[model samples]
Target: MKSKHLILIFLLIVSAKSRAQTNHQTIEVAQVDSKKNNCVEIPSTFSHEILSESKSLNALKSKKIRRVELIYTRYKENADFDQNQLNEDRMSRLNQLLPKLQIDKPEIVWIEQIGATTSTDAKNYFHGFRIYTDVAPVARTYQRTHLNDLANPAVDFLIDNTIGGTFSHPSGTQIHIPANAVIYDNGKPVFGKYTISYSEYRNAAEILFSGLPMEFKDKTGSYLFNSAGMYEIRGTKDGQTLALQKDLSIDFNCTKNEAGVNFYEMNDQTGEWNLLKSDLFSANNPNETPSAKPEIMSANSEQRIKRGVAPDNYETEGSSKVYQQLNLVYGLISSKFGVYNCDQIFRIANKTIISPKYLDVSSKKPIKNQNMICLIDKDVNASFSFGVKQITCNSQGENIFLLFTEDGEIYALKSEKDKRVNLNQKEPEFLMENITNKVKTSDDLKSYLNI
Candidate 1:
């Protein structure tokens, strides 16, 4: 009955669109968001940078063989999730799994973002996750603790997105999901095996959830059964009563079996997902839902991390090493963690700071340095420069500096372009002897010059 109504609703929605007059410009299809328009044409400034980082990170992420970790939750979540490898042991095992499975390691890690509610307060949402690894998607063995709660409500969850294309799922998907019931941390009306249903059976896929309660509003709750054969329960003051603005945590899981492509799962807690087949998906998006791929939501999600830095689904491709360094710093600042240390790699050349005299006279100097430093490539195609207040560089250049102050004053080092040197245990030789203090109050060239 729900499926019939959903189909009718889908038909009605489509019929309404078809009935509209075609003569006028209709918002139904004529709408083009600024982001799409902007993103389509990569900003010239970031064009090279994005492509470069994209290629570099792609190489690292798109290895021929790969293994990935899947984080699942007992607190209902989606089948496919996008997450990164944070644990060193987990990462090593994944790196090794490819060879054992005779398949390439994974280019992406599928996390099963789950919802949690500790026994301490079924009403309160707890930030917790249970991790597992899907060996070439063949089988899954959980890492660390494996706890599935049936009584407590979930506070977090996920959505399995099917990237639309030739490689995507056809018609729909089927999942042979594994779930158990229990109550952790404890207060619930009852504790036993409850039925699990899929949203597809309810026809609620591609829809947004709203009108949720703030916390556990009441002792009783209602389990909403969707057209997809999945049961979604909402805790309320009463079974029939509804609470607006009350946030409820969900514990869920689902499976998606694509024809001829093997099976995959969306773990409810860990946010880790993967393919059950011995294959690597070079073209897969963990964030996009199977039914609808929303661009705005993708942009806003912190889950789309740029490698190890930003959360997967929330970032763009960049140097993973650089991002790792930044992550350490950010972690310390936001969390209770203390100061973080980062490593930087430098590229050296024959000269520490290339002198204009090293080049042949070509009328137009490849690099020009006056007040600020301009480190230009010998070919003059790429250049990087840093200054007192602003940093402007050619699209191909990478700036390795920290902007400590918003005003951009007092650099940790004399910020300049042509800075390809890294300072560590071994310091490269600099032409500092020519660094004559030229702070002349008289404002003369000689007075201002540091010889």
Candidate 2:
């Protein structure tokens, strides 16, 4: 009887250890109401180990989730690790996985907490994720119409997926896809006809209007992108998105032939740009034989012309040609379907962070949340979007500041040539001239700023 009792105790201990190892971390999904105290927690057996097949996710799929707040807990045992980087990695993994489980992209808010470290057990120290779903959606703060108008339209092309081919943009940018290179998200092969949508942001107007983020953040600090050219390409079939099983080639034409330009791709979920590869520019040949390639060139020249840094017809003599032979091309190879940019980092020296108050010219009243502020450094092909926040700018660089109102109004702060603003002062009020009637389009805005 004693031996049988000992065996029973041993079995119970083993079973408890097995359960602890299997369920190392818990993931809870809670529904949040308007009142902070009214959070109703749903019973969740969802653990990190079974995230892919969680019944908690199924419960969320039926409801309309406006925002998702991810509350993550880290134990003191991992205090040495970089919390910000770990947060980003976990958030990125969740963002990628949640969408696959039929959860649409919602506004994701991350909250970090430190867990108690009284127990030295590894399972106790394991990080956990608690998700709070907000059903009530908030109204958009900015004017989407103005942003949409400024954005460049995608150039679509239908391609045969079975036998891949090269497609050229009117700007002379060529996308070369290999045969049988397309696949669905689940690694399933895709066949038949697929549509490829491509968009390019070559110049200041294109970059500014596209509303695509050019800021790259690293461990050191945030840096702006001095782009040679930026392009977004995506593949889809019938309404489903497609991915590249292999790398596709891009013969990117650009006006600038600068060396040391690296390729970067933006994260669809986080809006973060990750550096992929670097390429050198080949020597320019005006009479060189053109491949069925596309052009990313002329933007550098066009920008220079617009900024009065270069003479008119620097690369052309009033030619109606899209692909100018005089421009340089950077051969880029990408394995993903998303936004790609060939750019160099523009480090802002002596940076100043200022929360300037915006005032209307006509009424002389302070404007808040009703306008979007943009600071453009045309020399470096860098633009910063300051939407009711502390604006950071290079104290030495000649930056152009423009305010875009909600009601389609435009205003500009007069920047004198080589006159630098005193970075020491805080809360400087900028009186801007309302140039709404003069600027009809992005081109007009660019011209007006140049003048």
Candidate 3:
């Protein structure tokens, strides 16, 4: 009886061990399947609409995330097409269309766009793009490594037959192939560029606009962080002054409150970056149909200006805060007025600098009644009762004021002291008053500042 009992105990122990191992294996298999289904597979030959929908829908189906970041690497096409034919096509369009409707060859070519979206509750999504050359080999490696994070482009390119390799050389040939790129949101092109490198490896690059040597680098992949600003490119092409104007903002991530680059351009001479009338989705104006003579702009002029001009630093007591506030207000006003046709705010600020009404604090004193103006006063309480008051003076004695009105509107005012503003001043009058707008609540004030 003792022998039989020992045998039964041993068998029961063996059975328990077997059951434990089986459960462990089942868990391991389940984990692998979970990882596999973590990503949403994109279909080939999808339109921009379908691609966007896939991102949003796939994002929703994932685990509950507070934020989803979608990063897109712009499309990169091969240079197989005849350069001569492409140039001829541009010329053909230029010749057929009137000068006003003329377009130019997009210096930037974007393709193989890959991005990822992370979402919270699948309803709010944040998208970001990796600004890299999506060459096939690099993309393939990225795909295997970043399956759950990186987006897959609908189409991709294969490496040329010119280079073959089991491994790349330590010091390979330094080839500089022109590349084009742009940032987009919801199928709309926001920022266009000619800043990409097409080679075996991806180049982390920055953008150099036509008239600016300032290299704006992309942060957190190829997307510029806090990039909502205005950029201008103006030059004389064929003696008919040409200008490229860009108004850029970020597509705010709903969960994180972070923004990525969203760029747009205006029709030449429209003086407004109107999304409805302008091309919003194309980095190279893909939607712009009419072709114009190839625009030839040299970077030399921009370089010269950047080197020659040094910005004046206004050192004044408590004026720094005033300047900061003024900048915030300017941005807000510009955005609110973005709908209406207007000149660049900097130009307006420059014009305001020469206004005679602006106090030259270098030689003047902050007076309550001297700089104030009243457009209307119901009680005939004019003078300083409903206008600007100089609250502080900079080291150069520039007046910084707190502007207020009877209708509960208030603004911060600063005297423009840039050399360019002074040189361009034909007359000194009170144009700086444009900075003063009556707004209610600090939130309204902050909104104007775009904070």
Best by lDDT: 2
List model 3 lDDT by residue over 258-296, tens digit each: 122233333322222332222122253222222332221
lDDT of 2 at 207: 71
Candidate 3 is scored at a TM of 0.16
After superposition of all CA atoms, the RMSD between model 2 and the true structure is 11.5
Model 2: runs farther than 4 Å from truth? 1-146, 184-191, 219-221, 282-327, 405-409, 418-423, 435-441
Q: Summarize candidate 2's per-residue lDDT along 105-147 as a digit string, tens digits.
A: 5545553333233434324332434443442111112324565
For model 1, the stretches where C-alpha displacement exceeds 4 angstroms are 1-417, 422-451
Best of the candidates, TM-score: 2
The 10 consecutive residues of candidate 1 with the worst lDDT sum are 329-338
lDDT of 3: 0.23
lDDT of 3 at 146: 27
Instruction: List, residue by residue over 77-171, the lDDT tens digit for candidate 1.
Output: 23342222122223334334323323532333323322233333212321211122322111111101111110112121222212111100011
* Model 3 stretches with alpha carbons more than 4 Å out: 1-227, 234-261, 276-357, 362-451
* Error of model 1, residue 26, in angstroms: 67
Q: Local error of candidate 1 at 316, Å?
A: 20
lDDT winner between 1 and 2, please give it.
2
